[model samples]
Target: MFRAIGNEELGRGTLGHSLHMLLAEDPDFPSSTRSAVDELMRQSELDCAVRAIIIAVTSAQNPHDELEHVLRSHPALLESEWMCDIRATLREFGCFSLY
Candidate 1:
Protein backbone atom coordinates (compact mmCIF):
# COMPACT_ATOMS: atom_id res chain seq x y z
CA MET A 1 0.00 0.00 0.00
CA PHE A 2 2.76 2.40 0.96
CA ARG A 3 4.74 1.42 -2.11
CA ALA A 4 1.81 2.26 -4.36
CA ILE A 5 1.28 5.58 -2.64
CA GLY A 6 4.93 6.53 -3.12
CA ASN A 7 5.00 5.73 -6.79
CA GLU A 8 5.93 8.97 -8.54
CA GLU A 9 3.68 8.11 -11.44
CA LEU A 10 0.65 8.02 -9.17
CA GLY A 11 1.43 11.13 -7.11
CA ARG A 12 -1.55 12.53 -5.15
CA GLY A 13 -4.09 10.38 -6.93
CA THR A 14 -2.46 7.33 -5.38
CA LEU A 15 -4.30 7.64 -2.08
CA GLY A 16 -7.66 8.14 -3.73
CA HIS A 17 -7.36 5.05 -5.92
CA SER A 18 -5.94 3.01 -3.08
CA LEU A 19 -8.81 3.97 -0.81
CA HIS A 20 -11.39 3.13 -3.46
CA MET A 21 -9.87 -0.27 -4.03
CA LEU A 22 -9.65 -1.03 -0.33
CA LEU A 23 -13.21 -0.01 0.37
CA ALA A 24 -14.53 -1.97 -2.58
CA GLU A 25 -12.56 -5.15 -1.92
CA ASP A 26 -11.46 -5.06 1.70
CA PRO A 27 -14.31 -3.57 3.62
CA ASP A 28 -12.89 -5.15 6.77
CA PHE A 29 -9.68 -3.21 6.61
CA PRO A 30 -8.43 -1.76 9.90
CA SER A 31 -10.06 1.33 11.37
CA SER A 32 -6.78 3.27 11.19
CA THR A 33 -6.52 2.55 7.50
CA ARG A 34 -10.08 3.68 6.94
CA SER A 35 -9.48 6.89 8.88
CA ALA A 36 -6.37 7.71 6.91
CA VAL A 37 -8.15 7.07 3.64
CA ASP A 38 -11.11 9.18 4.69
CA GLU A 39 -8.87 12.12 5.51
CA LEU A 40 -6.95 11.77 2.26
CA MET A 41 -10.19 11.57 0.30
CA ARG A 42 -10.93 15.14 1.30
CA GLN A 43 -9.70 16.16 -2.12
CA SER A 44 -10.01 19.91 -1.74
CA GLU A 45 -7.90 19.88 1.41
CA LEU A 46 -5.37 17.50 -0.10
CA ASP A 47 -5.17 19.58 -3.27
CA CYS A 48 -4.40 22.70 -1.30
CA ALA A 49 -1.53 20.91 0.37
CA VAL A 50 -0.27 19.45 -2.91
CA ARG A 51 -0.35 22.80 -4.69
CA ALA A 52 1.53 24.48 -1.85
CA ILE A 53 4.14 21.75 -1.82
CA ILE A 54 4.55 21.91 -5.59
CA ILE A 55 4.92 25.66 -5.66
CA ALA A 56 7.38 25.60 -2.81
CA VAL A 57 9.46 22.90 -4.44
CA THR A 58 9.40 24.69 -7.80
CA SER A 59 10.72 27.93 -6.38
CA ALA A 60 13.14 26.38 -3.92
CA GLN A 61 16.85 26.41 -4.64
CA ASN A 62 16.92 23.18 -2.68
CA PRO A 63 13.62 21.42 -3.08
CA HIS A 64 14.38 18.76 -0.49
CA ASP A 65 15.05 21.42 2.08
CA GLU A 66 11.69 22.98 1.41
CA LEU A 67 9.70 19.81 2.10
CA GLU A 68 9.23 20.49 5.80
CA HIS A 69 8.45 24.12 5.14
CA VAL A 70 5.87 23.28 2.56
CA LEU A 71 4.22 20.73 4.80
CA ARG A 72 4.23 23.09 7.74
CA SER A 73 2.48 25.77 5.72
CA HIS A 74 -0.47 23.44 5.17
CA PRO A 75 -2.16 23.20 8.55
CA ALA A 76 -4.66 20.59 7.39
CA LEU A 77 -1.85 18.32 6.30
CA LEU A 78 0.19 18.92 9.42
CA GLU A 79 -2.78 17.98 11.59
CA SER A 80 -3.69 14.89 9.59
CA GLU A 81 -2.88 11.29 10.42
CA TRP A 82 -2.55 10.86 6.68
CA MET A 83 0.69 12.84 6.93
CA CYS A 84 2.23 9.94 8.81
CA ASP A 85 1.01 7.61 6.08
CA ILE A 86 2.61 9.87 3.49
CA ARG A 87 5.93 9.88 5.33
CA ALA A 88 5.87 6.12 5.62
CA THR A 89 5.03 5.84 1.92
CA LEU A 90 7.87 8.17 0.95
CA ARG A 91 10.29 6.22 3.10
CA GLU A 92 9.30 3.04 1.30
CA PHE A 93 10.11 4.85 -1.95
CA GLY A 94 13.64 5.55 -0.63
CA CYS A 95 12.91 9.06 0.41
CA PHE A 96 14.76 9.17 3.76
CA SER A 97 12.61 11.86 5.25
CA LEU A 98 9.77 14.32 4.65
CA TYR A 99 11.44 16.78 7.05
Candidate 2:
Protein backbone atom coordinates (compact mmCIF):
# COMPACT_ATOMS: atom_id res chain seq x y z
CA MET A 1 0.00 0.00 0.00
CA PHE A 2 2.87 2.35 0.77
CA ARG A 3 4.52 1.57 -2.56
CA ALA A 4 1.21 2.00 -4.35
CA ILE A 5 0.50 5.38 -2.79
CA GLY A 6 4.03 6.67 -3.24
CA ASN A 7 4.47 5.45 -6.81
CA GLU A 8 1.02 6.24 -8.19
CA GLU A 9 -0.31 9.59 -9.37
CA LEU A 10 -4.00 9.01 -9.18
CA GLY A 11 -5.50 11.83 -7.17
CA ARG A 12 -4.44 15.34 -7.88
CA GLY A 13 -7.48 16.12 -5.82
CA THR A 14 -6.21 14.36 -2.73
CA LEU A 15 -4.68 16.39 0.08
CA GLY A 16 -1.53 15.18 1.82
CA HIS A 17 -2.77 16.09 5.27
CA SER A 18 -5.93 14.17 4.61
CA LEU A 19 -3.86 11.03 4.09
CA HIS A 20 -2.02 11.63 7.35
CA MET A 21 -5.29 12.10 9.13
CA LEU A 22 -6.50 8.86 7.58
CA LEU A 23 -3.52 6.97 8.86
CA ALA A 24 -3.92 8.48 12.26
CA GLU A 25 -7.57 7.54 12.29
CA ASP A 26 -7.25 3.95 11.15
CA PRO A 27 -7.45 1.89 14.33
CA ASP A 28 -6.67 -1.25 12.38
CA PHE A 29 -3.44 0.09 10.92
CA PRO A 30 -0.38 -1.59 12.32
CA SER A 31 2.30 0.34 14.18
CA SER A 32 4.76 -0.84 11.56
CA THR A 33 2.66 0.74 8.83
CA ARG A 34 2.55 4.10 10.56
CA SER A 35 6.28 3.89 11.21
CA ALA A 36 6.87 3.19 7.54
CA VAL A 37 4.96 6.30 6.54
CA ASP A 38 6.78 8.43 9.11
CA GLU A 39 10.14 7.03 7.99
CA LEU A 40 9.31 7.68 4.37
CA MET A 41 8.40 11.26 5.26
CA ARG A 42 11.81 11.81 6.90
CA GLN A 43 13.84 10.83 3.85
CA SER A 44 16.10 13.64 2.59
CA GLU A 45 15.44 13.23 -1.13
CA LEU A 46 11.69 13.28 -0.61
CA ASP A 47 11.81 16.38 1.56
CA CYS A 48 14.58 18.49 0.00
CA ALA A 49 12.26 20.67 -2.10
CA VAL A 50 10.02 21.55 0.83
CA ARG A 51 13.01 22.59 2.89
CA ALA A 52 14.00 24.67 -0.12
CA ILE A 53 10.60 26.39 -0.03
CA ILE A 54 10.89 27.42 3.63
CA ILE A 55 14.45 28.55 2.91
CA ALA A 56 13.41 30.37 -0.26
CA VAL A 57 10.38 32.13 1.22
CA THR A 58 11.99 35.55 1.70
CA SER A 59 13.42 35.62 -1.83
CA ALA A 60 10.26 34.11 -3.31
CA GLN A 61 8.38 36.28 -5.74
CA ASN A 62 5.29 35.17 -3.89
CA PRO A 63 5.69 33.34 -0.62
CA HIS A 64 2.38 31.59 -1.11
CA ASP A 65 3.25 30.64 -4.66
CA GLU A 66 6.61 29.25 -3.59
CA LEU A 67 4.99 27.24 -0.82
CA GLU A 68 2.38 25.91 -3.22
CA HIS A 69 5.05 25.12 -5.76
CA VAL A 70 6.89 23.20 -3.12
CA LEU A 71 3.73 21.27 -2.30
CA ARG A 72 2.94 20.53 -5.91
CA SER A 73 6.45 19.68 -6.94
CA HIS A 74 7.06 17.69 -3.83
CA PRO A 75 3.87 16.48 -2.25
CA ALA A 76 5.87 14.97 0.56
CA LEU A 77 6.43 18.48 1.95
CA LEU A 78 3.71 18.35 4.55
CA GLU A 79 5.03 15.14 6.04
CA SER A 80 8.57 16.49 6.09
CA GLU A 81 10.36 18.55 8.73
CA TRP A 82 8.31 21.65 8.00
CA MET A 83 5.23 19.89 9.19
CA CYS A 84 7.15 17.97 11.84
CA ASP A 85 8.38 21.19 13.40
CA ILE A 86 4.89 22.58 13.24
CA ARG A 87 3.63 19.48 14.96
CA ALA A 88 6.37 19.58 17.57
CA THR A 89 5.71 23.22 18.35
CA LEU A 90 2.06 22.51 18.64
CA ARG A 91 2.85 19.58 20.88
CA GLU A 92 4.90 21.85 23.09
CA PHE A 93 1.73 23.80 23.56
CA GLY A 94 0.00 20.50 24.39
CA CYS A 95 -1.48 19.68 21.00
CA PHE A 96 -0.29 16.66 19.07
CA SER A 97 -1.92 14.90 16.14
CA LEU A 98 0.15 11.72 15.93
CA TYR A 99 -0.63 10.42 19.37
Regions of candidate 1 where Cα sits further than 4 Å from its true position = 1-44, 51-64, 89-99
Expressed as tens digits, the lDDT of each residue in 1-99 for candidate 1 is: 332343243333456344434443543433333344345445454643443343233334444445554455445565655455554554465243222
lDDT, candidate 2, 14-67, per-residue tens: 343345345546564334343443454566545433322333332333445444
In terms of TM-score, the best-performing candidate is 2
Pairs of residues clashing in candidate 2: none
TM-score of 2: 0.34
Q: Each prediction's TM-score against the native?
A: 0.29, 0.34
Query: Which pairs clash in the backbone of model 1?
Result: none
**Candidate 1: minimum summed lDDT over ten consecutive residues — where?**
1-10
Error of 1 at 2 (Å): 21
